[model samples]
Target: MESIKASLPDVIQQRIEDLVNAQTTDEEMAAHIKELGCRIAALEALAPEEKGEEAGQLGEAVHRLCERIRRDYVAIAYRQGLVDGMRMDKLAAEE
Candidate 1:
């Protein structure tokens, strides 16, 4: 519990966890997650500058977070594409 909260601030982590545990469609969850990522990115960009090693650490953390978010977005897009393709195929078969 403390470790989880340490990794991410309590509020942010809790909100994300809530979204994950919610009874919602994958597309809806992905959209909300993307929105949350955008908000976090904006906040990071506006954060006050740090010095020396601290700045480097912050940069690394941001880089890793961006990569994770990008990967997740790609996965969501791929899944959505597959769903759309399947729907199209079904419609064509009915036609």
Candidate 2:
């Protein structure tokens, strides 16, 4: 949705593009993205009368999805030795 695009932070937009273009055998990233999309769609499907808490829950779901993507990105980067410093605590923080 255009509104959704407008609402997203630029960093998040870039991250989504990066994830889509990333070269890897793992299908989990794509699957996770798909699941997030589905959750967003479900949120959109909610009745107009049922807006507050349902929307909040959906927001949290999206946050969790973003966190997962970040974790996976960090893990893959660490595995490839792309970055010099790898900390278990950083990865654990995502959970």
Q: Pick the candidate with the highest TM-score.
A: 1
Per-residue lDDT of candidate 2, residues 1-95 (tens digit): 44334434553565577768776445876786678777676776663656857786776777687878788878876664433123333434444
> Model 1 lDDT vs. the true structure?
0.62
Query: What is the C-alpha local distance difference test score of each model?
Result: 0.62, 0.62
Off by over 4 Å in 2: 1-49, 82-95
lDDT of residue 54 for candidate 2: 73
Q: Tell how far residue 67 is off in model 2, in angstroms.
A: 0.6
lDDT of 1 by residue, 1-95 (tens): 44443433654555577557755567875786677667656666666665445555665677678668777866886776676566556655555
TM-score, one value per model: 0.40, 0.36
On a 0 to 100 scale, what is the lDDT of residue 25 in model 2?
41
Clashing residue pairs for model 1: none
User: lDDT (0-100) at residue 53 of candidate 1?
Assistant: 53
Alpha carbon lDDT at 84, candidate 2: 19
**Residue 47 local lDDT, model 2:** 34
Q: Count the backbone clashes (under 3 Å) in each candidate.
A: 0, 0
Q: Which ten residues in a row have the lowest lDDT in candidate 1?
A: 2-11
